[model samples]
Target: MEEAMDGGVRFSSLRFISDHVGFQGTIKTSPSDFIVVEIDEWGQLVNKALDEAVYETSKIEPEPCHSVKKPKLNIQNVSIEHESHGEASPAATRYADRDQDHEAGSENEGSVNGVTSECEKGSAGLLRSLLDEKTHTLLDRFASDVKGMWSSKTELTEPSLALSLGKVLDKKQRAALHSAVRQEFPFLITAGSNAEVVVKPSPEYKELCHLVSEEEALGFFKYLDARKENSKFTFKPDTNKDHRKAVHHFLNKKFGNLVETKSFPGRDHSAGNPNTAAITVRFREKARGKRSRLECERRKAVCTAFTLQKENLEMFEAISFLAVKLGVIPSDFSYAGLKDKKAITYQSMVVRKVTPGRLKNIEKEIMKKRMNVFNIRPVGDSLRLGQLKGNHFEIVIRNLKNQINDSASLRERILEAIENVKNKGFVNYYGPQRFGKGKKIQTDQIGLALLRNEMVKAIKLFLTPEDMDDPVNKAKKYFLQTEDAKGTLSLMPEFRVRERALLESLHRFGMTEEGCVQAWFSFPHSMRIFYTHAYSSRVWNEAASYRLEAYGTKVVKGDLICSDEDAGEHFPSSKVHLVTEEEESANTYTVHQVVLPVLGYNVQYPENKVGQWYHGVLSRDGLQASRFRVPALKLNVPGCYRHILKRPHNVSHRLVRPDPEVEVEGSHADDAMPSLSLSFDLDASCYATVCLREMMKGDI
Candidate 1:
């Protein structure tokens, strides 16, 4: 980090929390290797330091292999801005912020809407703008990385981009990434030093990408015939743009005469599985004691849950007005799945009213915005998470670590982990990491969510930054603060609802709650919001390192179950008080009631399904819950390796190199097709791959 002399751009201001933010400035890739670092925020260039970039040493780790040489698949995916339009929904105004809300925001701002325009109107809308700075950076990184390893003219059993991005890296790395990508400013890190600038995808650039489900996307392939036919490839990478890119051009040049590479774009950007993804959510009425949250759905002559087009309106923005636009929900509308920002998605949203005009206003608004009009029919059934009998995750693992000498051993280990996670089990973690490094946003979000829920008192007591709370503060020293415990806890009440909904929809499994949890969410049946603690003698300490922006859990009771003993070991214990009312010397630091998921061969049901597995589930008759509410709150889990020590003593040079693959890694849903994923999602966003990554990382 550059020492500041009054006017300067600080490194802390730019680095991302969990980024492989490679390269120093403007994401310029070298001709040989891709520069990697975490770019959560960028340091403003100070006039003085600009002329004096000194050098500092990094505490680099020793690994079996360092250099990587990716295969020359010569596969190139060029992304441009994706566009959508939605003008119909009058309620679809700008997002509500503090200023906007004070200026008289509408009741529908936070409510659930059926659909936004097929193309536009949401911060997380379909196909993030490639023009956006962070998203673009992410995409560019992939493009650059692919350039280094892939040569389009190669022959292989089967391959794809998503495979590379979703495979390769460890589960922890992927979890460091989340679902929606960062458009700009990744919370990146490198060799224990902050990079000079933010390395997130360029949010400023409009982003265009495939939003289709993997199954469907993989269906569209660069057929061997196409490889045979694509010899006359016209597309090529800009040599001056990225470093890894040469790999593509070079390999293609070498084997272009022998292999063929074709690009076939499918609907939703490319091919995606048509196997419908149906979710039944049970949400509570917004108002306190307003009965179960509204459960609104499409009445397509038959009773089905309400489905929404991703772009219809902003989900986060519309949280305040679900009732007026979609009709009153009985608080029974809880869902297991969360829709994505790409393409048109089909999933049931909840609502209470089931008449014809139930969603007339919403429907009318949808039409105006050009949003896809799907049904919001009611269901004879209630939807829930883990209700779909688990996802059939199928993805392509590409551009594996260049050092793998025995493909068989690597593949075996990869598959073994899946099975290991299943038997050894894993946690059912949330994939959103937007809360920033050390889960600062998650802390604030959880604190605020609790405050909004009238749990202000609890928020105050648990989230209070005792001595050292800010993840960025240099003086403060409560390392446990880095765990994002508050954020994890905050998401749970809603998780309860989500899981319940999963049970309602699938009826394939039943998850039992572990009874009442602790007031601070430090007990079982609760989610552990790890703070990336910096303290020692704690469970989450650095010795037990956790990836930034990742969620960890254990299963105490649920449809998804394994041995009870494994629960504690898999997830941290609850923070407890020696006595119920005693405010003693010892700190409360145990995290309990975690529900872990199993993966791979150890899976009990869906014998043929692949990926990380969920051990137990919400059984058919298990306390038939109507709604699930995830509420983030403050709690403590110490020693999480979230404390980032800025390189106060070092200067910059001989930058670190990026790992070859941060991509698709999973077993076949049924071995019906070769899986596919992208590498850019590497060290980036895990939610993008959702079920695919979860399969590999899920806590059973």
Candidate 2:
């Protein structure tokens, strides 16, 4: 009864549902075998955006929110001026000649009188480095306002640090600093009329301007004004760094204690007065938002929607990558279920409170790094997981050599297979993807080890060899065998940063059992949740499979059946009552619901053999009913119900015979295969491959 350490789902175990060898041949020979198109709650496909139309529509001005007022700053006449140490350097001319729109170099500039070729090259390199450093620093420090201020054609705000060199430095230092600024900062052009430098917007600024207009920006800020009243974040007027740091430290300590105690309003029966201690500090009074003149302008957010095209990228991975590239938090992005990595997928997602121009920058960056990844223009509202009704699939099953000679018989066989599925249905087992690939200990094993307080075992599984081909993994295996955490750090590649981080933690925390487990928890919350969920899902799968064999999709007199219209929100199994004879008669043949429990602290078994089977599965795994209640971690898996049967809608098919003339995009025309193009629609959390397996009649 022990789970397979190899992480392979034995198709033989699912024999109760159907025969394993119904048909023989593999699916997913290529990424094209599986295509996923997500459908929104309105029963419509989440379609691709027409790039040109999307761009044009994004440019249309939005109606302004009436609550906001304009500021009284004169930004129209701002211009940049450059002052020379002695004679102006060639860098000055280069800055002046930089194409306004493109931010590119011009060929019209002449060489400096005394500068050598080598010196020019060095200066140019230094300038490039300094410019990059300066740009990144500004971007990070003022992220919210960077899009608007940096790209404005009419405004040039004062630089955070002066570009001037004072008498405290020598002549050489001053000249070097002067040259660096002139080569970079395109804002510094010819001398201006004012005593101080007055920056003027150039063509470069205009090109990178905000996609959301000022009116829209103001509207969003006004909306935030209403949100701020009940917000967890309390804004304070900008203050000294030391004061802010101390306040942050205090709050962190207080919050940590609060979370550990689980103390909220009206739930304060703790022995110690933690709330009184926190209140005595009065940090909230000091940090509370004040009625500032520019309060609304300071915290504006613009939501943007875009169509993402990714080749073999997990939804979370793609979103995380984009967030890092855009210099934003991953929490800013919202998406539905994770997509398959080996398949091409297109889905809708939203980046909240970000300008379309910045979103465009992120898209451009992704294309540059990964030619396969792309994004259409951003448009409207924010997106969330499970906000959609389902997904539509356009799959191709290739190499069907078992077919009959006549087209009529071939068609009938396929239809019969489909019809069998329509009536008999298929068991909803969590696919192999939920566990992970290859013959090694799965994440669920590590999660189970963690739950059992077997920290050393969990760490070993993580560090031990998973992929032999990967040199870094090979090194990890060696170090794990030798029990040398410190030695592994140098061997770890940059791509294996997570492993390196773990090793570093092991070194710092002294390799104690608790320390190792704490180091595991240090990983991203999503990854930790993934490990726990994998284990919970394993238990659920076993229980469901057992119930299927016992019941055979038949409604017994004592059986609990979910209403077809309920959508499996509250599991019928949890609140079971004896089925009436009339109800059993109606459901016996046309039973549409099969509910299975996902194990958690609150989960209790049903009253009968089915319930005993659930408990037996838990016992075999060396887990108690309350094993999910791990207090050390914040992520207590509150498991829920899952539907054990799903059927597709809007089903159709087509046959594509091999031909040089008939070709699909991305696939080579000459390298064609005689394939069946199968299409269908299924609701959220349902796997298309599961449905396809029933129709294809075997291993896929």
Candidate 3:
């Protein structure tokens, strides 16, 4: 184990399933080579749903707030004074970020009330147009920046807005002045000479109020900031009302409860409508299937089936974008499994509680983008992972020359390869997609870091930007490489929202290993689960390969042999047979099960040759049976079993008609070569690429 850790190769190694193939060919030279059509649970293409099904609406629930201790203030070295200016000065001028330094005035020399630098509006005119364009501009800026301002040591600009502390006040007195400051900032109001007068700030001034704590500012900024940052990252809310409501809900939740005010929670208005005092705040109801199908059509969930024709989008990300556009969470939708990001895949998806009319609207919006990407309809029920009846694939193998020029001989070779795969099947190895895509630092590496209690290392792995050509990302990557969390965070773009959230957490919680781990957990729960599973899968794939090599197509005594049909059931609890001597002899040529262990705490291997191999593999990776039971991290991986063998069903093929135009740019049209098209179906958890590799019978 120690040696393996030192080597680093222990975690990076992966094994292929079909080490023994009889044919030699190539496949997938283009995105079109692989086509996946998801078959729904009812054994039909997931296309659309019936009109009778009702749409389910998710209720908003109040989330319990986690208590974060406030940082204590050091007032010993700070100086405070009381100054009474009988009359208020004019509002300060607005300047650009760079221009602020050149044009300066004495401290608090300008207006006690802030001015509207953009519109040149004073407190007098601002009150009249308070709900107009200027208010939105101020709110948007505050929403976009408050989160990043907490740990930020941004230089203080001259105070644009001030509060009238009736008498002289000390630093402690300033810190205590919270209520007026809090309520005033949201309304873009600043202190003025008159007791009730407040003004706007200069447009050029760029800084946070020193009087209030960063934690207090989070009250109004949390949800609004999230919305703004998400918008920048391409998550557009469904409507203006939804945007306001969501922000309001989060604010109330952040402050522990609704504030006692006339306009505490505002009401929802139509799209583009300005919010009134009574904002509508939504809290989720803790109820499952609250309404039956017969109760109300809109109350129950309508399982809408859809197909996505994607070129370059992750399944989760695509769903997130769609959900945001509709003012819903991605969790509101479900799918059987994730697909490749860089492929032209027509895969299945289902969303609950959305109306057909709403779907049509979503479709129109998608169409406006000029992309023929998504198609939607209604189904009776929502789709869950592994609820599908497996996937059917239509593939093309390209860039290979026929070794035999004779058509009959080439066809014979292809048939022989197919026959070999049909009898023996291919290994159900986890593909590269299971690990992190297009990166040297795989998910399993992060999992290992987690297991080792190296939270700092794990967090670093998460933030380590990929080696790419993006200039903005490159700059952020440089900061990350140097372990400069604040610097990287300051430069990080909105698209890197997850990373930004982590940095903010690190800044707030202190950058210790525990803090980093806690910050890491702040990410979406599904992602954390994915990271752990990737490591388990890597171990399973490597072990399966070794087991197959040791006992090739033979059932040894005490070997757990699962049936092909029962393979889909939980393998760990599935029925298995202890091959007796007579049964082994009788089924010598008919042996058909492969055991792939999903490493976890509850795993128990047979005391056979395969058991020894599993133990050896685990030890080499610095892993033990007990390490799988990490209850502290909530990662108790109860080991399971998976059948290593998978054979495609309803297999068929045909020659693809070559285009007469020879679209090869300069190639002669008459000399165009013919291509082959193969189609087949496999069970759930089986990769179509494995089947293609088996048919090709060569190195991929």
Candidate 4:
């Protein structure tokens, strides 16, 4: 079999198992035309409706967890210099003005400790009307005590102020008393149960008192003590860029010349741009000279698993959107696999430190965006890639080339193809998607460039201008001709994030060789590895084709077979056994049991002609087995094995006449075209397109 060329890269010599002429049609006529439901490791379909009962029962209210403490101060002392009164007393005029402001803003200020301003105002009014003159006098004395404690210069302990409300019979009266105390002393943290209320200084208030007492101590820098090793903190990677900018601005404003904040690209390449970066705040070298310590207790990790159903959204974009909504970084989220971007997909995802209640609350919002989340519950472990049993696909192949008017012929043709697939299976080649779309330079080409240590060529492949007349291509063309990163960026759209990121790095650092290498590193780690993986897939496809042509369904000597015990594991190469001459003569292994290695430094080639063919193929491409280990790039292709063939499970098909009344985009319904609908389940990493290609005998 000869390789076919469609995209920039060749198909690398793939062969078909079925001998049928095959039918022609188009898949994904609409987003709903292709449906995918993930089958989890437990063999349960990840459907939102199926988990409704569990979701409803598992719903929990968010706990009152003050994970992020507000830096805003509720208590401040301002010295007023009155010409008539010379210098106004610190305790009298300041307290009186503060009390007036609190009363005036009681109905309009934002929420305090989850209590609405309306509730706070109403409760305060009720308390005022219910309390007697003697009670008011006692409250005033308590307020004075609180004021005196805050005014003192000595190191402050937690201020304790308690007043008995004399066993109020009405529950509403006791609630009103609690609100009144909160309104009068906003800095106090209050706790109420039954008829009693205990008031103490808030964490913010205590910190404020400490700052006032120790005027010599630097503000935020004191927390970053140089004596304490590993004292730095990194903000979550999924933190919004705007929010991060605001934090940087705030730090510069408050602790001017005392601290520095630096942003580094996040390790999680699975997230889209902006969310793909993280910020680190640290004390400046000059500020680190002072010796001070501040300690923070770490919160325990919580992983909440949920089923996310999305329509026409890429996995990284969806994760980034969810991360922004949930106020977490993309790295905090884990999923079993990446689903299709052009179809409706349901898959399980787990996010750390997020509660089920919080995820549940976002369902309506996510639904508005063509996505929904449900089946939310706390799981002990996080989901990893390839953790699922497989994916179930319900695909509609529409606009049949010749069978539009002949339902009987369409049915017969589909059944014949299905039977062939069931008996012999399709060639297990990496789908065209692995090579990327259109006539643009394929990912494998970029991988080859990287392997050869050609940094500039790899970048040029990424930024090369296609023949399209779009603004993005024009921007690339402009950069190539003029090398004006800033000018090119202005013409590019904001949504073209990867291109913009590269241009920005080039603009900042200039177009030196080191700058280009740095620009390459600007991409997420996963993206950097994807290029090499595609190259490996290219080699594997060619090797698989050669093996089938030479050995034709025979499990010969040196063939690697993974044991049944290792079959259940995600990556079973660790337990693979090589067939001996005796085993080959005895026919101990079947063709279905054989596996092929995706060329890598650590992988063992078969001790046969097929293995020798791998070297020939690599040598032709100017690569060797050892080149997979690129230490300079921090990339190591340790390699893995994949099954040489796959037969889809529970295959079924039907032919349907299009409804005259229903309108489907890109569908020939008015012509009464018959559509071929297929339902099948494939194991993890197997491309469904390859199965379709075997039946249709057309380029996918």
Number of the top lDDT candidate = 4
**Highest-TM-score candidate:** 4
Sort by TM-score, top down from the best: 4, 2, 3, 1
lDDT of 4: 0.65
How does each model score on TM-score?
Answer: 0.25, 0.60, 0.57, 0.61
lDDT of 1 at 443: 34
Give the TM-score (vs. native) of candidate 3. 0.57
Tens digits of per-residue lDDT, candidate 3, 1-700, equal 2123323324223333443434444555556666677765556654344233322322222222222212221111111111112121121110000010111112221121221122122323432333345643544455345434434854423232222223212323332222223233442323321112223332211222332234333222222211111011111122345544544544333322212111332233443444533332221121111211212343244666667666555666566567766676666676777776655566677777675567667776655432233456555545545556777778776543445433445556666667767766777777667776456578887887776667788887776666676854674576566766677677777555566767788877757877886787656445665677678887776666566667766777656666654355233332444456676777742445645567766555654787787788678768886676444454545556677777788888775546665466643333344556788888877877656555665445
lDDT of 3: 0.50
Candidates by lDDT, descending order: 4, 2, 3, 1
lDDT of 1 by residue, 1-700 (tens): 2322222112132212221111111110111112111111122211112112221121112122212212111111111111112221111111100000011112222112321221113324322431346644555575455334423523221112221122112222322222112211111110100111112222111110122222221211111112111112222111222322332343234233323233322223323533212111111123111111111111122223444444434333232244335544323344434333322333344444444355644676655543433444434433332122111111233223212243344344444434433333222222332222233233323422332333433233233343443342321122124433333333323323322222232222211121112343322121222221111112111111221123222111111222222111111111111222121123222222222221111112211111011111122112111111223333222111111111111111221222335333652232232222312211111132322233333211
Instruction: Extract clashing residue pairs from model 4.
Output: 238-329
Decide which is better by lDDT, 1 or 4.
4
Worst 10 residues of 3 by lDDT: 93-102
Residue 500 displacement (Å), model 3: 4.5
Residues 1-700 of candidate 2 have per-residue lDDT tens digits of 3335444235436533544223333466676677787776556566654457545844433334223223211111122212122232323222222211111122211111211223234544654453356643542343334434554543543322122111212223333433333333322322221112212223322221242233322322221111222222222222234544444453344232111111122123254433321111111321222212123333245666666767655666676677777777666776665667777676777777677687776556787533233344444445544556778888877665453333444545665666666666666666667766454777677777767767777788878777577887777787777777777777787555567767888877857887786777556555656677778876766766667777776765544444443352322222333456676677642335556667766444455577777777678767785677565544555455666676777777786666676556777332354567778877777777667665665545
Residue 226 in candidate 2, Cα distance off native in Å: 16
Winner of 2 and 3 under lDDT: 2
Name the runs in model 3 displaced over 4 angstroms. 1-29, 47-305, 351-356, 367-382, 402-411, 472-476, 493-510, 564-566, 569-574, 578-582, 585-590, 629-633, 657-673
Q: Which stretches of candidate 2 lie over 4 Å from their true place?
A: 1-11, 16-22, 50-304, 329-332, 351-354, 368-384, 403-411, 483-486, 497-501, 507-510, 557-560, 565-590, 659-673
Candidate 4 stretches greater than 4 Å from native:
1-9, 49-299, 323-329, 353-369, 401-408, 563-574, 631-633, 659-671
